[model samples]
Target: MDLEKRPREGSETWVDPRERPAGPAVRREPDAPEGCLAVAIRIPVRIVVLVLVVPVRMLWDALVVAGRFLNDTLLRPLGRALLWLGRAVFVWPFVGLWRYVVVPLGKALGWLGHVLLVVPLVWLYRYVLTPVGHAIAWAARGVGAGAGWIARGVGAALGWVYAWLLTPVGHAVMWVLKGIGAGLAALGIGVWTAVAWLARYLVVVPALWLYTWVLAPLGRAVAWCCKGLVWLLSTIVTGIGTALYWIARILFVLPALALWRWILTPAGRVLAVVGREVWDALGHAWRVAGHISLALGRLLGTLLRWIFVEPVRWVYRSVLTPVGHVVRDAVLRPAAEAARSVRRTTRQALAAARESVRQARADFRRMLFGEPRQPQPVDRREPSGREPRTLGSSTTALTKD
Candidate 1:
């Protein structure tokens, strides 16, 4: 299909468009030409609105004026009366209480608190606590000084003893060791000289004669063999050491140098050359992934809107919300009213029961106890010329009566 020439109502040649009824043309007035008299004579929108709304505006202004007059005449006086009454009834007493009672009481309390608590605390801190702390500190300082003096004296005594006795003892011991060592050395030299003379005359002369007569040639042959063996082993050891030295140099040291020179240097250069490219590629990939993620999120949001949100919103608006309103009005409202009535009835019953219980208690008390007697007033006057009655005379008179 050719989208540009698509048909709206018909399929033939894809050229048909929808036909609809047309209403009569209603034209707007063209704007007045610039610098013309019509442009200069244009009425303001506010003026037009004012002309249209004059009666309503006048009515509103008259109402406002009447309201203001009424407020000023009646409400203002009433409000002032109420304010005056409030001041007289509530504010005056409060002010009096605060000024006369509360202020004086607060001042007294503050003075008492300062005198009883704060002043005592200050005195204690100043006199007792400070003196105690200073005394403790002085005692500690004196004890520390005494301890340090005693330690110094003890150390000096120990140093003196070391210098006087221990030094001489150590020197004497060292001298004794040197003398003993000299004596031992001299004895060892004499013993060695005697041993050498004895061996040379008694043993060496005979050994030399025997070697000259019988063993000299054999000894020379054995010596020659030993020299040859020693020379061969030395050569072998030297050759092995030289070989090992060259092998270690070629394998470990030379390869390390070559690796540093060739592989590590070139690898560093290559890494430097390609590091930026790799970083850029990674950054570009990250941005592309981020864009894809955002696009996916938007697409998912659109799909969710279309599939779930719109349907849920439609159902709520069309069905659930109206149902909820109906339920609230029909069921919940009546239930709330019934609950309030029940609560009121329950309160009335409870009050009636409480009254009945109180009446019953009062009746029970009246039944259990007879009427209580009222107390008589006492007469305290004494006769003019009579002495006060004694306790025995009063008791006898009461008995006679």
Candidate 2:
């Protein structure tokens, strides 16, 4: 309520209505015009141009479509046909050229390909494989040479051992054989000397004594006896000869003459008549001998015919014919058939018998032992340690146990 500074309304305290105070001035926006209405009143040229260009663009599109249709329907098809006709006109000649020239060129190219592939392989064989093969061959040759050297060394060593160790043994053996031979020779000489001396003493002296003392006298006595026997035989032969001559003259000669004169004359007449009768008898005897000879000849001929011809025929017919048949039927054919049967049967029987025996053995073993015997399995695994039994000394002790 202290009115000490009351000021007039229009004065500086009222801050003239048109002028702001000094601290803060009032800001006034400029009055811009309504540009949106003006923009709305202006005509849009893009819309007019769009309206006018649409019909013209449609007419141009129609012309393009008409051109595509004319090409597709007539012009393009005619062009394709002309190109096909041109290809057809040259096709046969092209094919002929390919067959005559190009095909041959292709074949040559294939051959060249093969040559190209093979040439490298051949080069590899020459430069790489050949050298490797030669190296292998050389290695083998070296190994063989080493083996040969070893063999030669072993042979030389063996030869040296034989010369040093065995040669003396062989010489000693030969000397022992020579000594034994000499001893045997000496024994044989002594035996021969003893036998010769014994023979001289036992046989020669006795033979000489007997010859001197007894044999000479016996020889003289035998000679004297032989001379006496010869003299007696000559005297007896002379006496018997003289007595026989006297007897023959006295007794036989006179009697023989008298008897011949008395009896021979009548006997001669009778003998004449008997001789005439016996003339026919001699013929009869000759006829009988001829008949006997004929009978013997016929008998011998019949026997010969029987032995050579008839008996051979009989043997062929009776023995050989039946024997051949019997051999074919009973021996040969039956033996072959029986052998075949026996072989088949033997195989089957052996198989069956083996099976039976095996079963029987299995049954017997099972019955005896209450279980079939099984073979002990062999251990393939490496042994962990040696068993006490495997030790030689321990095994010897175990044997006593």
Candidate 3:
């Protein structure tokens, strides 16, 4: 405050320089109004829309155009190419599947057809061939049978012809020769008989008489000498016989005693053994006999029943029935008819017998009296008293009549 040096009444005094206010304080601008800020934001947004959005829209439109062009041009061809490649990839596998599966199935079906055809063929061959072969064999057998029969017949006929024709001729020739031989034998036998008789009567008779008369005496003398010698020889032989008989008796007795001593000691054991053997043999024989007897009895019973009873029964049924019928028809009926016929014939014969006897009596009287005395010379004609003509002339005349 000084009026220049006077202090100003209301003014404050300045402080030290250090404490003085710094240079003028910088003023800060005032915050804008909300409406104004809004107005400014709207204006920038409008400008940004004009500047960015229009260009982006134009670029998007171009991209869209480019994508549509790419879809139309490149993508369609690529898709078509991929589809073709996929089809190419699968085609070979499909062909291989058809070859592996379908072709094998076809071959299997063909094999089945072959089996079906072959099986029937084999069956037909078996069935038809066997029967046909059998039939052919039977036909061959029949042919053989026929040939055998023909051969047998021919052989039989030839044998029969030989037997009947040739054999009989040969037998007749042999018979004639046998008859001639028999005659010759008879003649020879007669000759031998005569020679034997002549020899016995003529030669042997004298010889026998000579032997009896002469040789008998000589034989008796010689026999007397022989008897004397025999008596001497008998004396010598008797001495030798006595010695030999004693020696033989001693030898034979010794052997017999030895044999009895040796054998008789074991006789009981031997007999026991023999008895056992005999018992076994007897038992065996008994069993065999029983078996045989049983078999034989059965056989005999069967034979008796078959041969005797069965045959008799069969004969009674078979033969007797027919035999009885035959007897009735053949014998009884015929005999009955014969008896009736005989009776009828007898009756008829009896009825005709009187007339026959009368006729026979008349004939007998006529024969005895040289003709019945006819009415003597009824005077129908003159009696020619000439003797009757000779039998020869009358026979001739009767023969001419």
Candidate 4:
């Protein structure tokens, strides 16, 4: 806002909904001041809206609490258990098979193929094929050199024959041909010169004379006649256009403009006033309705707590709690102790069986594969990819992580 629009120091700066804009003709205008119609609309609308919205808001709050409680107490743990079970039953077995069985078998097969096929192929390529290729290349080079020598000798003989014997004969023949060509060329030039002179006099001269004298004057006269016709037609079109423009203005444009300025404009202003009042009333009613709904929601919540929650809480704490404690101490504790004892004895028996099974498996494995090797620690200066960093570790750029 500009300085003129800003409120002055020490002035009451708060806006009043009832306040109208500062202007000379503000009273004459329809949409500025709030009217009796707005008050008539606002009061009933707010009351009706408050009544409708209170029940909805209360139900909405109840549903929100119920949903949160269900998600936390029932749905959340069930989802987690399902996720774990799915991984164990469907996903883990495939992952283990790929990692242990398929990967190792593939590696062994690849190693076997390399040893049996690739190694011999490499040996043949390096030892047998390489020597044979070198021998062929050496023979090819010898052949190429002999052929080149023979070609050079043949070329020298051909050059000598051309220079000593054929050169003189060719020169004599060329000299005779040049004399005959000179005579024919002189004769052709004379014939061509006579034909050109005849064509200039018979065709070109007459055509030029006809164009300069006859065609140019005729074209200019035709052009003048065309220009006169175009000028007369344009003048007639301009006069008709001017007459039509004035006729349309008087018949259509002037009356329509007068109707809008004198009639429709006033009616539209009145409609704007009614519409603005309705809009402002709706806005004020909505805000008032919100406050009323909030108050009603609080009142209903208080009533519900007194009627339902308080009674349930009282029953759980004052009645059910004592009964639960008595049952737990009198009968449940003794039963739990006996069950725990039985579980302990069964666990001991299962542990012994598991020990025997583990020993037997270990003996079988040792007999077949011998004792497992322990990994030796190595000194390193750089960190491994994706491993957590520590005080002793430093990373290198070659690590993708």
Top TM-score prediction, candidate number: 4
lDDT of 2 at 359: 99
**Candidate 2 per-residue lDDT over residues 290-367, each given as its tens digit:** 455556657877999988989899999999999999889978998899899999999999999999999999899888
Q: Which pairs clash (backbone N, Cα, C closer than 3 Å) in model 2?
A: none
lDDT of 3 at 140: 100
Candidate 3 off by > 4 Å: 1-147, 233-401
* CA shift of 110, model 1, Å: 32
Structural RMSD, model 2: 79.7
The CA lDDT at 57 in model 2 is 53
Off by over 4 Å in 4: 1-105, 165-170, 263-280, 341-401
Worst 10 residues of 4 by lDDT: 1-10
> Taking the tens digit of each residue's C-alpha lDDT, what string does model 1 give over 1-401?
11123233323333112322366534344432333332222323223333444445445555776799999999999999999999999999999999999999999999999999999999999989999999999999999999999999999999999999999999999999999999999999999999999999999999999989779888899999999999999999999999999999999999999999999998886665455434544443444444555566588779999999999999999999999999999999999999999999999999999999999988898789955678996644333356765654433545443
In order of lDDT, best first, we have: 4, 1, 2, 3
- lDDT top scorer: 4
lDDT of 1: 0.75
lDDT of 3 at 8: 36
